[model samples]
Target: MAPDPPDDPYVLHARLLAADEAAFREVYEAYVPLVLGVATRVIRDRTAAEDVAQEVLSHLWERPLSYDPARGPLRAWLLVLAHHRAVDWVRREEKRRGLAAPHEAPRGDETADAATDGLVALRVRAVAAGLPDTLREPLLLAYYGGRTYRQVAAELGIPEGTAKTRLRTALRVMAAALAAEGITP
Candidate 1:
């Protein structure tokens, strides 16, 4: 018996790139659930997740040519991009809420807490700086940005599997690095 033919992502991409609405719709319908799943992981809000998914689709429509088969599969690429964008959105939202940064220091308590926060920030920055862009970006998007694995995949423009693998690898390496610095999660 013959094996089923592999789905030609490049052909599909070309059709979508040509602005074939039906082709675009097909891709959207096929992938929205996956995208939403990833977005929700990051934003932790249904509405925002949906919005991010839509944005991801819009980006695909606008720049279909950006999907390069030579680098990796199309699904991975889309998911990575989604993940990155969703995490960015979440981070921005957190900043807007003032949950991430202190607004003003209380006389005595503020000064004490500020120093600790600064120290942690410095350590985190140092660790992050030490990471290559591949690992650092994904880790930041997932942990700091609050995006799901799928969302991270979309943001990075890689496959869901690749995203999962990268996250796992990044976490292990970061854990080891942090442990050496006496930072325990």
Candidate 2:
């Protein structure tokens, strides 16, 4: 039997469910340039973008069930996937570059430290209460519970970069509020 023509994206998508070789080839050939473009725009490096594009396409090939034609067209879905992969790559690179500082807890003078810690806790609570839940939750998990950023992301069901960004925003808001009160963390 002759294999079906690979012109229609919907047909190709359906064929992917069976791990069809022709459909996979058609998808890669049709979308590689577009996916590479989106990844490069976000990553700002052609070589790394090519890696991202390859990973995204390979993910589609390996986990074809992850895609939903009902959500949107395959092209748009590929673009979104490529973009997310690119953003993740950029975030990883930023961390590798030490662009963000890690937060550390303070310690000293046990008796005096307890008293000052109580006051600081109250002030932190006041500032945190003013933040939106989306920003506040990850911050609390990472700081109060002493969770790693990745743990916070997993606990909150958010992307790791989003968790990091929200935590940064929350800290900034708290810092501004503390500054207005003539205090610094």
Best by TM-score: 1
TM-score per candidate, in order?
0.51, 0.51
Which window of ten consecutive residues has the lowest lDDT sum in model 2?
104-113
lDDT of 1 by residue, 1-185 (tens): 12112447777767877898887877777788867776776667889989999998898898876655544445555565666666568667767787655443212224323433454455566667677888888888998999998999998999989888888888788677645433444
Listed per model in order, the count of residue pairs whose N, CA or C atoms clash below 3 Å is 26, 0
lDDT of 2 by residue, 81-100 (tens): 67656766876776788764
Off by over 4 Å in 2: 1-7, 101-185
What shift in Å separates residue 55 of candidate 2 from its native position after superposition? 0.7
Error of 1 at 59 (Å): 0.2
